[model samples]
Target: MLTSLEFRLLATAKAAPELRHRLRDHGHDVRLCATELLTNVIDHLGEGTPVTVRVIGTAAEHGRVRVEVTDPAPDSPPVLRSAAGWEESGRGLALVDALAERWGVDVGPDRKTVWCELVGDGRADGRPVSGAARPTAPARGR
Candidate 1:
């Protein structure tokens, strides 16, 4: 299913349980990816940006659940950084890289989408979607 939400702190927190419920059996990892993507938007792109989130069931990677987050900032893309031990921030996409089977970004003139997929075998009610699987690749800070 496709659901668009405003990029807000509380809205991101609220999305977790709702996505967990929506994805049902494949909820756990998908929910985590969704949270991370939304958080990135808030922390990087600024809060209150119009964000579109989409979740779909697919046969890629031997059956997976895909989550996509679209925002208005094309220049502010997601990057994987090496967070030091003393730092308290900058690990959101690291977690996404670990949990998602694959993830990538789609850039446009006015917007960009950061998407990730997780290995899943359960059922969902959305169309099939495709994303690159970077299981062993280091996070590219674009």
Candidate 2:
């Protein structure tokens, strides 16, 4: 299944439950990752910027559900950085990293997509695939 939407901060709050329903058993992790990615867009690119969010599911054997957030800012890619104990805000991507099987940024001439894949049988309680090495930064893809 594949779902896509024009993103807006207000609309997202209402969209969450619907997104969760559409994602079925993978709802929790996918919704959280989608929220973090959307928040990054709002924080860094401003709320009204053109953004599109997509959710795509693969075959059961693949055990994968991918979420992608595309924004018009090709130059402002997201960064993954360690937040200081006293800081309150630099942790979005870190949370994405923790939950995604692998996440990356795809830069294009007019836009960039920030995406993450969650791998599992959709049966485990919301955790990422076991033993996957956490990446320090999101990989760059075409």
Candidate 3:
């Protein structure tokens, strides 16, 4: 079974308590990205939303996790808002755009899903995906 985005957030939080730690160590800023994405889907996209999460790669903790938050609002897919500063609202997708590795929408007649994928660094055996995410050693003698 695959883990939900909420559960993934919790697991990442447990694995690395600090936000920077989660981002740098994991090679994917999934926590903040997921938060913004889900919030956008819930607040603006539609009500009674259903989000689907998928993890694909070599293994559980070493793969690309794509999160798709589906909503009933089909006509309004996510769009980038180019608003001036000091605006009353907006900017979720903008932040998502800046943060996510890749993000887009899957549109349908009666539904739409805004999806984002965060590729893991794949550090189960001490080697990172691109030599950028070196795994931190476990704390000893608890």
Best by TM-score: 2
Return the TM-score for candidate 2, rounded to 2 decimals.
0.71
Could you tell me the lDDT of residue 38 within candidate 3? 60
Tell me model 1's lDDT, rounded to 2 decimals: 0.65
The digit string of per-residue lDDT tens for model 3 on 15-85 reads 22333343333334555565566666556644435554322222256455454555567887777887679
TM-scores vs. true structure, each candidate: 0.69, 0.71, 0.54
Worst 10 residues of 3 by lDDT: 133-142
RMSD of 2: 7.5
- Pick the lDDT winner: 2
Runs of candidate 3 exceeding 4 Å displacement:
1-28, 45-63, 121-142
lDDT of each: 0.65, 0.67, 0.50
Q: Which lDDT tens digits does candidate 2 get at residues 1-142? A: 3222333333244454554554455567777888788778778977566677766554244677667888888999899999999998999999989988888998899989899887753423553322222222244532
Residue 38 alpha-carbon offset, candidate 3, angstroms: 2.1
